[model samples]
Target: MNSANLNIRTDKDVKEQAEQIFAELGLNMTIAINLFLRTAIRKRGIPFDLLLDAPNETTIAAMEEGKRLLNDPAAPKFSDMEDLKAALDS
Candidate 1:
């Protein structure tokens, strides 16, 4: 099969970040881009969702609080469902 060079203009940091992500997924940029192109052709559209529904402020705060509680030694731990319910009731 014949191959072609595809040149693209992208921000250095963005390219580096993309490379890191692709590497983590066991793919190089060429394979990742080719997969994307083939998938796009098969789907007749972009292969992934473009609309990103990021966590709202309330959700972010709750997640941060959950993490803090997880790391806290003083955070209560219940041995079972009844114990958990008892703690909640107290």
Candidate 2:
């Protein structure tokens, strides 16, 4: 694959932090960046989610409720894929 130069300017503190992380992962900054670019090209999305944090309490509660409902023994069961598909079509 062809490649070109990508120049970015970051604060020294940020660069130092990134270098430490890359070192821990056994990769230099260049390799890490190349992997990121390759993955972004392949997936057409950012290499990582980059979320600041997980869902907050309200969102977590709603997700847990949904999971409970799905796994409840008393929940109705569809016979097969076709039945589920039919239900969706209806």
- List the candidates' TM-scores in order: 0.54, 0.52
Question: Mind giving the per-residue lDDT tens digits that candidate 1 earns over 1-90?
Answer: 899999999999999999999999999999999999999999999998898889999999999999998899999876799999988899
lDDT of 2: 0.91
Which residue pairs show backbone clashes in model 1? none
Q: Which lDDT tens digits does candidate 2 get at residues 1-90? A: 687889999999999999999999999989989998989999999877777877999999999988997899997568899998888899
What are the Cα lDDT values of the candidates? 0.94, 0.91
Determine the C-alpha RMSD for candidate 2 after optimal superposition of all C-alphas.
14.3
Q: What is the lDDT of residue 69 in candidate 2?
A: 76
In candidate 1, stretches whose alpha carbon ends up further than 4 angstroms from where it belongs are 52-90
* Candidate 1: residue 55 Cα off by (Å): 9.9
- Evaluate residue 80 in candidate 1 and report its C-alpha lDDT on the 0 to 100 scale: 92
Candidate 2 to truth, TM: 0.52
